[model samples]
Target: MNDKFELPPRRRLPDEIRQRMRTRVWEGLGEPDQRPRWTVTVRGRAPIAVAAAVVVLVAGGVTLLQSVQGGGGQPTAGGQATTTRPSQQLGPLLVPGVAQSAVDKCQAVAFAQTTPGDYAEPDRWRPRFSVSLPGREVAVFDAAGPVFCELTRTTVTVSPAVAAPQVLDVSAPASAARVTSLFQTANHTLAGTVDSQVTGLELGLANADGSNGVLGRAALMDGVFVANLPLSERGAAQGGRLLLSATTPTGTLTGSGPVPDGRVWQGTTVDVWPSGDSDPTSRRNQLDRCLDRALVNGLPGTDAEGWQPGARVGSAADQEGVLVAHRDDGQLVACALADQHGAELQLATRIFAPDRTANPDVPVTAVDLSWRFLTVWGAVGPRVARVELVGENTTATGEVVDGTFAVQLAGVTDAAGWETRNVLRAFDAAGNLLYEGTPVIRR
Candidate 1:
């Protein structure tokens, strides 16, 4: 009856499957005699049901371990290798924060790409300068006389020390130069001169350190060219002069004098006009508005000082005038005749305001004087502007729009009782646009 009644579902399993299942269940029990003492702990009973559950759990744990540490140990589509380094495997070198490191980087770049003859020799023409660093120096070499020296910095008790020591030029002729100058700031030397047989000149900066910078050769322009360079050490204008002789085709230039009044003219006589009340005294501020030069009084070989007061006055002579025009927006526009100067001339005046039309050609509007600086705006080349406003936050920049300038003047509030002298500007209806002159108040 037992054999014919048909075995239960468990008894009907294949023989190999049934044997394997039985082996798993037996392994889960405490194997007291096994080499490793492998065993499974059940909370309550040691039944076959619990033993089967333990076998399945152990198999799952073994599969997970194989997946992580076997051939599949490499990163998958959604996973990354845990052994990768973060920094060296990614990007640039780790930069140091030391000041010397920063300085070294700057020096490397400068030395690699710097143009030759940027630094001057010992005798370049430049202004005085003060040095405040260590390891600074200046080098000088004399082509003609026996001259070679180096200026070096040292530490003194109270203040820093800088000393000059003479040396010999061991390499070749002192680079044979017709002219040389010492730039004051860098103390470096500049060698070379204009190719002129008639004129020989040399200039030097009084104070320069070796390590500052180098100077370059002079730049010459044809004709009796003149340059009014502002002295870097002092706020003074130095007059650079060049004399052209009939025998010489060109000549060297030198800053020989200072100009108290700002007049550098090509021609002998100039026409000038002053703005505002057009006072004759203002027009003749410096001996008929003449800056000190070869044409001024008491110059060599010229008796311009001996000439009578009215000797050089001619009605047809050029008229240099300073013009002050008014605008509807309470601004003043000042323009100076570049080459004209005289006392008995009429100051040119124009009302520079916006034209009342659909296509308006706006003029520069200047603010009235009220003992304070005001915003003056003018157009530069139809679009850009020159601006002057007084405030800590005032800033001016240029803009181009539709072939006309868009001048933006900001941080200007109230201006009263301030007289702005030599104020040149242009503007549109929106606001003031450009300014060029140095604004000054009259005493």
Candidate 2:
């Protein structure tokens, strides 16, 4: 039988969809997975579930507030440009880096305007970064003139690969999350989910000392990235993807596949295979995608190349704890810290797409993994849009304990016209659902 699954048809999702989804999965779905199909006995389920719950509660509250201020309809001109009072500001979540003291040691300066008005108008020039840190910086954003940040660090005109350096004061969980969201993996040709959600974020990728030679990019909503998207000529193809490789000095990143929504950097199509082979037509070499500089709070880097791309990523968060997403193989992989104390993480979990009700049996389309968590995300088109979750434990020595489980399905809406519900799912290390709260979408 040609089995086909389908999501419940609807004309439009309500504004509160984002909020309801978050509340349902994150806030404590009340019970854990009854009989999880996957489990590593040593791994517990309590702490992980609790942590996931915390994140859901916080995100849900923010979404609700945004809905109220934004109205239950689409974003308006005012809401799009300048946020009103009691708005959801984006940044390191831990600190606001606009104080004069923050930019004390920077040699050069550049401003990336994210607001809606002209730079001359201070009101339109939203205050994203308050200072410039060592390797973190921004471009003046003059589109026509010299629109790049200044760097004090010396550049070694050697191979792009360099020893990993240190980045200052960027270790908070929020900081790490912001940085990850900023660096859009070229592998995924589509305009990143970042532009749609994050209003402004600063990334700092440089040595500890106030130096230069770091590369990074920031965004204001509906700017350059969005302007070039949903490729005009190139239709949607699931081949393009993004990969972060810390195993190398330069921390190589590879993007492959056709440009689905041709907009930004859409001319040359790129693709990378599972076996690490590339076609002659692929822009694997030309597009040396790397972080030049990043800004957060106020500290922005001027040197576009002084700091190695992965250094900040490594120092700030555990390198082995990488959240890998592969479009080629259609999977999400997370590696554990590969240190002496860290466990050997290589177990990959696979889930069905959200619309899997059509086919009760064959659900998984692709999968990949390294260590901490085995994640899988893909679409079954609108027909079979169900998502399934499965896990595995790949530990050698002692028992491995995995904690925390949370899932977010972006671009979803609710039935009533009150909120947008973005489906949220939480599972334990053993692949058990701890909480299942759905939150309403505000922005």
Candidate 3:
């Protein structure tokens, strides 16, 4: 995601509004159209302005519409709607009047909820993202800087407080993003972005039978998407991780992501495979020999000779083992070992990676013992809640064990070019991407 892009705001316009405002946006032609003209141009395509004021909504990187022309007119594709005011560069995002009214009230609520020192000045709060429905079923939602407010014909609502930004992590967001102020919503609508290739969003909510079902969904729209969910507790007290599909492509891509509320649902971490050595004597003998060979190969840490067994990774055959030892700099030196003749062991291959037991980032390392076998392992930190290994021919999720994980893969015959063919990834509980790249290698 680009730093120039902001996070999705709160509230989803009703279905009737969605039906009236569907725009076709061609890929790679999408760019902000903000010029003073009698019309609006989106992605280099022009859309004519209506004779009357039409409601417009903009969030994420796209603009939404309530009406292309005046009330009852069909939606015009490829352009953002605006009030037909001459000499204006563009109309206010969403309906200016409704947005302002909601913002004013929301600001007061936020001010009351926020601690005195944390509150923003009134002028700093601006209506940057918004969406609305026109008529008696009005659902105008505006995210004015730190405050997220929603207005309907009968009631007005906002987030719980002026707090940190939170959203369902269907896709990676910009690093250290600032617009993460309002994620809480008093209404049932959840708003966020999905993978561009994703045509729809399906939420797996908990059922009474301890299973999950698609209780909510959002359709891809020209501007941004909004998910209408069944009304539940604002901060629903629940258990277990909800099924997450941050981005399942239009009949292709599928995956999990972060949830807006950390309480309701998050990534569930499975314990790593334990040191299941059916034969400790044989495993220790091999590990000791591997550590000695590691010393000869310039493995880090002054206590190489005293390095103890940290993990025993089983392989396809008894000839393979992994030697994991701590480096002096809090990193790890994992060496793949093989017995040449059973009297002693030889270091086949090695890797250097973070042993982030105390650090927040997920650690991953990969090494090929034999040209046909590869060993991958890492330590899971507090922030990491999920791990996946992907190759052109390989796909597997990592399980945790005492905060560490190790897995062995057979039939990789391309040691030198393995990284180019495989990818290892780790993610946070909300499906926010943590790491996505090749593991550190020490061949």
Candidate achieving the largest lDDT:
3
- For candidate 1, what is the total of clashing residue pairs? 70
lDDT (CA) per prediction: 0.25, 0.24, 0.41
Tell me the TM-score of each prediction against the true structure. 0.18, 0.21, 0.28
Instruction: Kindly list the per-residue Cα lDDT of model 2 for residues 244-358, writing each as its tens digit.
Output: 1111132322112222222232212122222243431112211111111111111111112222111001111333222222232222222222221112122222232343355
**Measured by C-alpha RMSD in angstroms, how accurate is candidate 2?**
23.8
The regions of model 3 sitting more than 4 angstroms off are: 1-286, 292-308, 316-319, 327-331, 339-366, 378-380, 397-404, 415-417, 427-433, 440-443
The sequence of per-residue lDDT tens digits that candidate 1 reaches over residues 69-167 is 212112234543222111122111112122332233323332343354432332332221121121222222222221212122110110001212112
Candidate 3 residues 90-201, lDDT tens each?
2112333345665666666556655665555666665555554221111223343334454432234454444444544323333211112133232344444443445444
RMSD, every candidate, angstroms? 38.6, 23.8, 27.2
**Clashing residue pairs in candidate 3, if any?**
165-180, 169-258, 248-253, 249-253, 257-430, 258-430, 271-400, 272-399, 272-400, 272-401
